[model samples]
Target: MSTTRLFNVYCDESCHLQHDGVPVMAWGAVYCQATETRAIAQAVRALKTQHGLSPAFEVKWTKVSPAKAAFYLALVDMFLADHRLRFRGLVVPDKGVLDHDRFDQSHDDWYYKMYYTMLRPIFCAPHRYRIYLDVKDTRGGPKTRKLHEVLANSLYDFDRKCIERVQQVRSHESELLPIADILIGALTYSNRGLASNSAKRAIVARLGERLGSTALTRTSTFATTKFNILLWQSREALG
Candidate 1:
């Protein structure tokens, strides 16, 4: 690991759309020093091997099952315990409440706004970042580019210097990305009140328990590196 002072942000979203028939929308990211990424991926591969699952298997929230409860739980434990890895989630409790028309912004613009909310708190001037987003389809590339522009505008990085690059990559290609998927899935699931999968329900419960609160739908004003969740609103809360 070099002393390059580089950071990597792995971003992903869950149930993000205007009308997905789901009430909640979540965009989240996992942050770590750039140098630690390889080590983290290797550790996750080892964990998969420990569970007797293929290291190549793509881990996702839907994969949670009673048969592999221990494996998922251990993965949660690893994220919580690892000092280098940090999690931040931005959840829209009710998408129906968002009136983009009233705000005079398009849905696409709002999408970038939520992404910026999910990222702004972690940006620092001295350190540069490379943001990797999970590829969902052809739209993924365009969305990634638009997000970079919005981020640069908000950061006042006119030269596009602070944010080194924004990219789209396959989920299986990056180990830490699935972590974002799993965490965001737990968040959206808990908010949506889905309990069909007892194993997933338990895994989400473990996440809430680790963060020392059950009311994850409410924003945590003061959060540490272990787990920080910001439940955002389209409008400002009354003071």
Candidate 2:
């Protein structure tokens, strides 16, 4: 086994729930050490310098149109591969196959459910990993608070294992945002691979093959059944 270092993960997901038209997908990033974090950041900085790109993650993602977005995305993928980093992600059905809309009325709840399900597998390790999530909510907003609460609440603590921490950071300001944006954009492109002839089918196939049906089925079922029970019980109590 590779001796675990001080692993810090910078993770994000695309297609937060069942994709309305396509497949739902989530991605995880693992940095084995602080140096790796710096290296990743520096590589992104280099890209920004070479491209005259802005510093923020959101801008990097939203500023570019889809075709050019894939160009920068390929660079990010190359960087990840060169660094020997690890990535985990998932793609599953949306409403047609799994009814996330019926389960989560609020966007907050829906995203939180998806986020938790994505994090579930990584929590099994014994080592300490600091998780930094790119924040979607605006600054000084109730939505940020809700994100924090939802993240905290979703953590599963077995009697034997506890999470070191789960932090939702404001990526709007971080230089890392650009890097993360490219990563997430790539993931979005990946999950939507059902569309384009130029799409990376080999990678998508590998991900689909690794993910299998069990994780998707279990997570969807759990979210659906739990939400139904909660709704039913809430109505009962009100009555």
Candidate 3:
């Protein structure tokens, strides 16, 4: 008689490569009740159509431009207004400062660790989750398996009842993945102190305004459930 609720989590990352030239790296996830996934995605497609864009059009942060600002902003507003959806982001302000040698771990090991840290808070007992990560590269399959193992082990869910599965997915195939990209992109942009793209800047500002924060550069309080952000500081930075 376990009345466990099932949830679907869509995850995305921005500039997570070890030597990607981008100093800031961010990972974000947008999750909702399993039953609502289809309706939410259809609503997003409807908004695209209302904005005169094709329903097949992908909503992406990189594609945001002055011409599509209204559409993108409306998308953000829609996400905020919907109580069913929730976002959590983890920002690594500076990857260059990481000392892998000292930690006795490779960059990939740390990468998975960061993913675990970002996701650990979202898991609660008596609730099951299926996580979908946007495929990043050729290692997507192996990464997914490793992440699944890590999460399941960490949670002591050896039977895989709580953490049901972690799978790789194409961002274009999932309506919710792009939303994660948008939020992660904003965190990365803000942390990198970039101002080259006016459209992106506006989106970041609007997100902060909607969240009642002056900036997205800072870590949101732990109590923030709607759009939670964790500005992760390395041991070196903390020292």
Candidate 4:
């Protein structure tokens, strides 16, 4: 009998376009046991109601503002305080430096590779995972299918048992996806060296304080399961 544990991974990305005018790109996911998702989502809705926002109100990084700074901070607090939740983020400090031609790959190819790198650490034997990515564009369907194939092939899970599913979903539909948005937003903002939005800056500072770190731009130790971050550097940058 297989006593495999099920986990749901909600993924989000920030400034991922090759020429988005933003140098830093980040990908993040917030995952929890499959059984806990319903409860966690309910809790999030309850927080929204307590904060005087409509239950249907979408929690988003772009929605973070001075008026709702307190609510956003509370959201961060809630996420960190919850033992069942964990985060993993991968940051690319400068996408402009990437040489896809030299690597003999397209940007889309590298994009999938980055997703795999961001998610590889979360997979373990005997544990099944269902990945949910926020729909980015019209290509969402194809991207999801390709990503599923890539992840499964990389893990040698050809039967797709360990990597159960990879699907595209609207961020507004899932309570957890917004959490990933904010986390990824903070990483990209910090790495881009932006401070124009005080509200966003406050949230970033709160994350640092909660994690006992002065800066979010730095990478966290790989073993830091609670809120792991990887500042990815390309070979050229490494050299």
Candidate 5:
């Protein structure tokens, strides 16, 4: 059996913020086994070649065009299924649930914090996890540094757990890392600004009920936790 100690996880997020009147929505975390990382890298290299993706292409190049973006989205799902890799995250911010002002004030940062929290529990046990977070902002400013600091601060306990490290990489150079990024982006576009209350509830419920049922560790602990997070969010929104 493949031990969990050698796992290297890559995570990305989309629609993570509620700047201005924009509704917050959709966050995703995708991962492959540490042992399988090399294989997954090879697969992505082949896909890039087949699709003529150049090394010099800008980050989020797949997102520049709709058709090409969708293709990569499908490709990501295919890779996950093929490798039996498990993932868990949420699509949030439909109308009446999340207001821009409220979200900003809460300082929750949804998936940014959620991914950190989720990874925390996994890294809790005596195993090592080297997590790679794909940089969402290339703008090179305070916002980007804040994100780096958040990730670093979140992993403060990992050094004691025999866990080696946490890293952030540019989305484009990260190859397979952007797959999760695009999935969340697609989710955001499909939900359309999270303006519909019914759609928001349905999306959150599905994430909790379905996506959370996936196998992450020897047990489906994290998936179950994700479901609970969805349910808790719903209750909090309702009250």
Candidate 6:
């Protein structure tokens, strides 16, 4: 660790492909001071052990089921109760409406712009940051490097002192990335009107209740720190 204060940011996204057919594409991130990462992960492992899961067992939104609903709920509560952790999310309500071709931009280009936009509110300048993204594909290595370059250039972090590193790590290796998955999944699922899973609905309701909102689709209240959501609208949608 560096001598200066550092923040660790973990990010994950759902249904990001241009042709995924999913109506909503979402990105969520959780960040905290670098010193809290180990402690938070250890606490999460402890919670898993309490649920009779092996400490090494990975927690993921895909694994949320009626049988494991209690465990997932507890994890959600844990995240909300922890003041050290902060979450920021962005949702494209309808990916099909995006017109990257008309804008003379590639999907990758727009994706990076959205990524930067989602992260802008949470970033604290004059402090170092280390960002970890869930590995989506082996082919994204170049994209990951480009993300670092783009973010650094935009922030004017020439020596990369402000944004130290941005890299992809397997979700199973991270405790926070899975939380991002679960949270973003809930937002996307609700906004898509997907009511197929009762367990998911219950979790979403509980989360909304906790945030004093009936739905997680809108922007979060400014007073809220644990969960801040942004519902992205296309230029056409605005028009």
The residue-by-residue lDDT of candidate 5 on 88-170, one tens digit each, is 54545452465436556454565346555545544444556676776545643554445455665666652335445556777
Backbone-clash count (model 1): 0
CA-lDDT, candidates in order: 0.88, 0.48, 0.90, 0.92, 0.51, 0.88
Clashing pairs in 3: none
Provide the TM-score for each candidate, comma-separated: 0.94, 0.56, 0.97, 0.97, 0.62, 0.95
- Model 2 Cα lDDT, one tens digit per residue, 162-192: 4444566666644454454544544555544
Per-candidate total of colliding backbone pairs: 0, 3, 0, 0, 0, 0
**Model 6 off-target regions past 4 Å?**
1-4, 221-223
Clashing pairs in model 6, backbone N/Cα/C closer than 3 A: none
Poorest stretch of ten by lDDT in candidate 1: 230-239
For residues 1-239, what per-residue lDDT tens digits would candidate 3 score against the true structure?
66899999999998889997888998889999999999999999999999999988988888989999899989998999999999998999888899999989999999899999999889988999999999888989999999999999989999999999999888889899999988888888888888998889888889878886544777778788999888899876879
The residue-by-residue lDDT of candidate 4 on 1-239, one tens digit each, is 66789999999998889988888899999999999999999999999999999989989999999999888998999999999999999999988889999999999999999999999999988999999999989989999999999999999999999999999889889999999999998888888888999999998899988886644777787668999988999897789
Q: Identify the leading candidate in terms of lDDT.
A: 4
Q: Which stretches of candidate 4 lie over 4 Å from their true place?
A: 1-3
Residue-level lDDT of model 1, residues 171-233, one tens digit each, is: 999999999999999899988888999889888888878776564667766656567788876
- Give me the overall lDDT of model 6: 0.88
**Evaluation by lDDT, superior candidate among 1 and 3:** 3
lDDT of 4 at 68: 90
Cα distance off (Å), candidate 2, residue 28:
4.3
- lDDT (Cα, tens digit) per residue for candidate 6, span 18-58: 99777899998999999999999999999999999998888
